[model samples]
Target: MKSYDDKHIKNIVLVGAPKSGKTTLSETMLFEAGIISKRGTIEEKNTVSDYHEIELERGNSVYATLLHTEWKDYKINIIDTPGLEDFIGEVIAAIRVADTAVVLLNAQYGVEVSTEILWEYIDRYRKPTILAVNQLDTELASFTKAVEDARRAFGNNVTLMQYPVNQGPGFNAIIDLLKMTMYRFPKDGGKPEKLPIPEEEREKAEQLHNELVEKAAENDDTLMELYFEKGSLDEDELREGIQKGMLQHQVFPVFCLSARNNMGSGRLMGFIDNVAPAAIDVPAEHTADGKEVAIDPAGPTGIFVFKTLVEPHIGRLSFFKVIAGEVKAGMELTNFANNTTERISQLFIADGKNRNTADRLRAGDIGCTLKLKNTRTNDTLGDKHFPGPIAALEFPSPKVRVAVEPQNKGDDEKLSEVLAEIHLEDPTLLVEFNRELKQVILHGQGELHLLVTKWRLENIYKMPVVFLPARIPYRETIQKPAQASYRHKKQSGGAGQFGEVYLAIEPWYDGMPPYKDHPVRDSEEITLSWGGKLVFNNCIVGGAIDSRFLPAILKGVMEKMQEGPLTGSYVRDIRVSVYDGKMHPVDSNEISFKIAGMMAFRDAFHQAAPQLLEPVYDLEATAPDTMMGDIMSELQSHRSIITGMDAANGNQVIKARIPQAEIDKLFAALRNVTQGKAKIKAEFADYAPVPADLQKKLSENYKETVAV
Candidate 1:
């Protein structure tokens, strides 16, 4: 609701694995900052960040929500993001706008999949990072073990900024290594009271303090010398070194807290203020057009739209990060991607579902603009000549796909239109129409991702929908060579037509000149060349076939190629040589030759060795060593073979090749097999011939379906 200049703002994003207390930590930070009168538990569905109906029902954030709270005269823009693997796009979007990432780890569980994922994302952006070991009051909470886990997960970059003085029910205070003081929680349930460090924990605290000093010294040679000489450093010197170290990604400060109980929130806020980088601290960003620009208040205005939200009643909302100069209401900026100018009708800062109009936005600030034509997420806005576009945020490929249909017949138009709008808001979700299958396919990261999208379509768009399993794209091709002929004769017509065609169909093979010579790159599907060297010698020694009919015959053969001789799917890699044919002087028309050619190809292909080519995918799975055998066996059951395997961070990275059909609804199977410990990624590899046994049955089925 209020705008803060770059100097007075602290952009911190809360990220981690699902159920890692990111939302809870946000609520605690808001309450402790006195932004809210009372804290709302996630179970009650009253938390500020997870306010959406779906989020409340699921008890996990499905999208990123921005909340602002003023603490100690600084504006802290806290971005609460989804921790589930399905909604990684939301986490990436939030990370792009934040200056620092506060990764929350469940003290009991330590690191999980989502936590490891966020670590890589934060590392990619190279932003200052802080580790918040949350839920310290839980039954299995252990600060020491959690600290060790963090170090193990993130390598030696992780350093403790503060350690829990006690654990579980005994968790009453936190030792602030920077200030060398302990903040003791009130036993009667009130604000924590500051006190001198206890004598018993003093020795351990000092040890941690020395460790902090050693890590901080690496940030600057002067600081390192200061520490070596005095065996310690002053608070101001240590704070400066910590900030420098964090911005350079040299030392990651780890802080402990119990977000659900609101313990250590105030200290968390203090650490963010002192440790997080300001707009000036981060390096200047480059526009998509390759121009380096600072967050200059005086330069030409430019903003990168990182997120888009669609409201049922309200218009489209575009969330943008200002990269250069400033933007104000009524100012128009060019959308370089589309090469169109969009007027900044009104600018607002997003606060959950509500947005407050702002007169203008300076660099390094996130704001929303209403109803910008031709503007979408990842598009940059700037002056007409300098329409800067920011690099698009990378998102994981969709792992699950399903065909969807409106439950009610009349909701089709509305469902299609509304889903299009919904997809504009969240780019991670995909909607596509499969003309061949006659289905509207929706793709997402996992099953839950699609489920949430479907739920939103029903509730937000007021449309009921049904989902069906995705069908594998199976193809048909011939295996052996065969010859056949067809004659077309129409005597009833005034211009009595007559044509004949003879063609041979053969198996498409590799290492052969025309077929095998096609560029074989590291991608799915080999490139096919037109008229390479199939040798279609029209050896009609006499005037039996007209020269003009050759094009018609080729066209007919091309059309038939699309609908293979076996399955009704597209055919690939075969050579059909039309060596001979007959034609009448007056009846050798294009239509006659077309029909004759089509029939001739059909006859020849049936005799040829026909086969089915199924789509295969390169599968990569990473899991603990204990589950390596299970993962490998699961792949084997899916008719897969391991290509390679290697050790990665005490886990096994298994690489295999599998059929796409076997991986449909793979998320469910993976969860069942690995107990949710294994994760996988797959990409289309190549279309290979089906196994001998399966090919026989499929070819038989294809013949029956296309019987004349």
Candidate 2:
């Protein structure tokens, strides 16, 4: 294996919407570089990037695949990410380690909804990006419209680097702006023959070329001065200017491509090798403690594991990037997170399912190894002298949730192991077994995301599972104050048990005034684990209740709070004052007091008008303006409170707050209303009181459950 420094390595992540030809382009790149003898199409199910069974079945990329092509003394590591929004976690992992992003656009549809959402992440990181308008050979492929869409979504920095000479159907040539030449490819599309620009296209080519030069020169003062003096820039100067512009996010160079036919991929690779930023060229990585780790092979040996894949027979494969130094096969590195030393038995570069063994991988290079002990997705393994932990990758919060259970019921333990492995691979899918609800909830990016998880559970793990509606984590609390008393007595036993408790229950709120009618002798405000607070006050007058018996009384009240009186939900935000009680000296034990307190609190809760509060979430949905009215109407019917609306990139962005129970309904309606073009993101806000009718129905349901 040949070792290249950080400067000779380029980590390029292929990202776009579905049918943008990312997988096909990946195959073409490998074939062009002679790594593969021939290209494989999606229909053939033999493409190197889409090697997974699930991907081949779906005929699309599902997970982020890692493939490298050694081209022109530079090793370009291409990470082909899924175009579906449900598998966004895969895209996020790929982008974090990538130095440059090649965002492909299907010229037929221009910019898609999924691609726009992914672009937000790329723009947020300010990564050096290249826009490849692929599939120019397809029918209705308009390069002008795609470029227009790019400028609208990505600002004026969308600079045109090449224009298709014959875009639709017979797209065989592209006019290069920087080279001032034309690349005419043969029918097969491997290598292109350099030719002069046709006279008919000379005017448009020169105009776009001048515009590209101006956009590039805006990034650096030196480039600006040179451009003004010479009225144009040479090839080297233009490349330098574009590199600087990409680093600063001042330019997104657009290239014409028909990745299916392999017309312009060779030139695209050449540009990536020369203009794309390498790890050495990108900004230094920051540690958790705010220290910078420069990309240098001579520094401490450090590798950060950004992804983990667990196969049935292969166990776990840890994919990592060498951040600061090189790691050989026999090297021993310590996991900075857990302080455990790990031995590098073997290092291998990955190409989908294929693994090519290598002696070592240098800084900024990505590779994978098997049989790592106690290493996870985000752990940083390095030499013992390496300073500290690297910054962990941030994943988006889950927006959709569903209850899941194994079909066999006996496979519960195995299902747990499967869910754990799933979470290890995709952090966005959260698995939680709710103790109160008695259900296992899987929270994910969307409905499709959960469906994919279910498919995996049934197929890969062989644990057939069924998905149910996730129960809302409702809370119970009183709306008004009420008083009740209870007496617990048992005469059958020797030393009869007898105790009585009198207490007042009222709603609790922040910074509320204390009760003054009976002095609050002592108050302990407790924060409930389920949210909200419970303030227990000991207000005994004339020794009505002994000081020693207060704990017993509080314990009973807490039991009632755990299984709330109204709807059997966790009670929150209520104050309880023990004003008076009676106890028999001979039989007044903790058990007697506990029973009395619980009965009394339950009795008072019914009189105090308890209300059930369901969890609510803040949601923001984006869709084209043509479908905004239909989406808004559907949302309004689901009790969504439309907070605001705005226009972004010629689309409507709707913001609303909705109860958790109605979330599924809103999205189901959106799919039909918008034809699956709407994108939504939701997060937990705060719990609010359910509607009056809903509270009554829920309370009645709890009563029926208790009776049964």
Worst 10 residues of 1 by lDDT: 515-524
Q: After the best TM-score superposition of candidate 1, give how far the Cα of residue 242 lies from its true spot, in angstroms.
A: 0.9
lDDT score for residue 77 of model 1 = 80
RMSD of each: 4.0, 1.8
Best by lDDT: 2
Clashes of each: 3, 0
Clashes of 1: 3
| Per-residue lDDT of model 1, residues 1-708, tens digit only | 566777777788999887888888888788888888888888899988987889888877988998878888887888999988888889999998888899988898787655776788899888888888988887899888888778877888888888887788778788888888888887633378878999998998889898888888889999999988998888888888889999898888888787877788888888777767877578777766666777766677888888898767787888887777788999988888888989999988766776778898777777788898798888888986453677678877888899899889787778789878888888888888877566889988888889899899889877889998776677777768788999999998588888899877666555544322222211122334321123233444455567678778877876776666666667676666666788888777999999899899888877887777888999888877888777777788888878999887667889988888788645567766776667788999888888888877766786787685
Candidate 2 segments whose C-alpha is farther than 4 A from its true place: 516-520
Candidate 2 local lDDT, residue 398: 80
Q: After superposition, how far is residue 576 of candidate 1 from its true place, in Å?
A: 1.2
Model 2, residue pairs in steric clash: none
